[model samples]
Target: MMNTWITASAVAVIAGVTGFFAVLRGSTFAAHAIPNGAFAGAAGASLLGINVIWGLAVFAVAGALGIGALGRRARHDVVTALALVLMLGLGALFVSVSTEYADETYSLLFGEVFGVSGAEVLPIAGLGIASIAVIGAVFRRLMLASAMPEVADARGVSTRSLEVYFLVVMALATSMTVPVVGALLMFSLMIGPAAAARSFTGRPGLAMALSVAIALVTVWAGIALSYRTNWPLGFYVGVMGAGFFLLGRCWAAVRQRRAVASPLPVLPNESGYLPGLIALPCRRPCCAGRSAVPAVLLCRPLCPARASAQPAAPAAPDNFPQKTAAGLLMARRGESSVCDDETSDVWPQLWPGSRRTRCDGFRLHRRR
Candidate 1:
């Protein structure tokens, strides 16, 4: 049981990390294909009387490289499907040639995690850590290429080279995970947690952390539940992965609803511009300007002349068309935004003595 835990956890970490990149790059089909199709390699190795791990690694890496070499950047899935078909056909050939059913080779198709030997645990964990280290070294460059391949290529980032390296690492990780979770259903364990984490968070580092954590929890729960219920471990892993993805979708939907409920303030229009108007610093201890902005709330109106002769004006009401926010002054089109008081400096422009005047589009009085 302890050995199973160690091996499963290590494999889960590798899958979770690589799955994030897989989702970003839209290489999900490849993720699923390589591990399952590589079963043929194990079968072939069984026929040759050699270690099955070597066979798995060789075919998986070869498939990745072939896909990289033969497929165009945007059309890799077509080539991936062709490779999967070929590998599965070869697997059948290998199995048919043998005189007896190879129990060990067949078990690799579905994970035999509960029967893991203690000797294999340390090596699996070590390989997982090494793979993670390599991924981290190129994490930034890979992220750029996956998210914006055109931009990365335009900047001379060598996106093609990056894809090859990334695919190679993915193949190696798939090899490691194949024995623990079975080739056919391994992608469920890898992709589910990763897709869920991405839905929950946009930051790459945080999403990756969440992906690893979710994968561990899913694997642990699967093993424990499978032990008690005696059901297939893959069944639990698939259900748990699907459930997490749905939960993440719910969270994202809720956030989107909240955003719609409260829209940001609109930008100022031409009417908001206080044209040709020079602002005199208010020395008047007024309650607030016409806008009622917080800064001058305890102070006074915008003009300095009002406070010396009379009490401060009240804070502007919400109904006032003038708004002193959003980096613009607001008012009705063709209206002066100053007080009507006769003694005010800006007021003269509003209502000149007996004569009609226009103040910043304000028609103060009728023409004589």
Candidate 2:
């Protein structure tokens, strides 16, 4: 039981830390692939009468490199799937050749945390610490690269290098974690807490802290519950992982609803206008792109969606376009933009002729 706790705790910490970056980097698929590919390593190790960790590590690193070499955002999953197929094929060959692999194989498939020896705890803990330290050193750079690639590029961060570094780290962590949580359940443990943390706060530091805390709690609770119920620890861990993610989704939904129900008031500038809020959303039946947000909440006048919407404009020229500005503004007139008032500088934004000086920019076409 003590060995079980120690080993599980070490693996949990590794999963928690690497999982945060995995989710941030959008490498959750890679996370799943690395360990699945490493399954063959465990089989080969058992056949050779060697430790499973060494086998898993070698194959996991290879899988990570293969993915790193081929992966790109647009078609990353396809590459990951290819790696998975190759690894699984190798695993099948290893399994079919061995008659003594049944018990060891089942243990690998479902995890046997209780069967872990005291000798295994030290290596797992030491390796877990090393992985965490490496992650912490590159945490900020990785976050920038993952969240804002353009900004990272401006700072001279190599996105390709970061991607390969992260995948290798994840591969190492997954190899160690598979012994405790099983390959099938390890991905859930990695993604669950980190994804849930993302919902509560967008700050990377706070979310990482939350992810670790959640993972620790989930592992501890899963162990305790498994002990009491005499059930498999991996099952409980997998369930808790999914439950935490769903809870995060529910929390995010609630926060979003509250924000919509009582929106923050936009402050009025000296000109009683805001730059991005210059025009109200279009209300024409053809303009289905209008935001669902209520216009009254964002600006002074009611939205076109409301029956008693305000009139076109007010007497004060300071608030020139007013709220129903888009309603009155013409989208186009021949080659240039059109405006209700010729002198007003405001024009329909994000259009071809939006920068036109005035509605008279183009002459009306005449059939000669």
Candidate 3:
């Protein structure tokens, strides 16, 4: 029982860490498929009377490479499905031929945490340590590649190589987890805790720590409950993992609602406006003449023209056309010929007899 607990705890930590990256990289389907694919190796090894660990490692690495190679042309889900079907079929074929150890085969599909031998502890710990060490070494590169592969590539990070390395590490982690969690239920431990952690926090490091802690709690609680009720460990683990994920989602939703209801801080310059008030574009004909102000003044009076005609209102900014004020004043006075040189060129085409004035560069002549 002690050995089983140790192995399960180590596997949980490894899975939790790897699962964080798996979710970030959008490879949950691959994570699920790889364990089942590696199960083929266990089935074959059982038939051949050899160590199942070597077989699992070999098949998992092969499957990872196969998926990576095929993923170039096809979608990852398609590639993963094809690989899963092929491996599962092979496992079924192997199981059919083997008459002895049928119960062992069943245990492999489900799990036999209670049956863990003392000798298995060292190897499991070694594998878990190795996986953690590799993850730590490539943490930054993996994060960069997972978030934005194109940007990582532009920054001279070898995204392709890092992807292959990550897949290999994931393969190792999957193989290590299969014996404790079973091939079918391994994805629960891999994704559930990590996903819950992500829902609770946006920071990657904090999320990872939370994921590991959640996984540890889930595994320990599952083991305790299984021991008390004589239920399957995997069942307890799955239920608790799912529950934590739901709790995290609820927490996140509550936070979001609180954020939406809270008042936003006003900028020092925007004291007159209420917090959270959106400033809209002034669309009155007077303000519409100037396109330089993209969007300005929220729900204020539309009579800026009357104020502009007076001396108190400042002149339009330099970006505005120089003739805009004259045009507005002329429109008010019921007169014309306020066209600037740029406008004069266009005015002649519009009004055939228009003449350009030297005094103010106004075009006065109009069509008869």
Q: Give the winner by TM-score.
A: 2
TM-score per prediction, in order, is 0.70, 0.72, 0.70
lDDT of candidate 2? 0.67
Instruction: Name the lDDT of candidate 3.
Output: 0.68
Better of 1 and 2 by TM-score: 2
Q: What is the C-alpha lDDT of each candidate?
A: 0.68, 0.67, 0.68
Q: Candidate 3: where is the Cα deviation over 4 Å? A: 260-368
Worst 10-residue lDDT window for candidate 1 reads 274-283
lDDT of model 1 at residue 176?
64
Please give the lDDT score at residue 217 for candidate 3.
92
Tell me which residue pairs clash in candidate 1.
286-299, 286-300
Q: Residues 229-280, candidate 2, lDDT per residue (tens digit)?
A: 9998878888998899999878766654443222223333323322212232
lDDT of 3 by residue, 99-120 (tens): 5656676677678888889988
Q: Which stretches in model 1 have alpha-carbon errors above 4 Å?
A: 102-106, 260-368
lDDT of 2 at 270: 24
TM-score of 3: 0.70
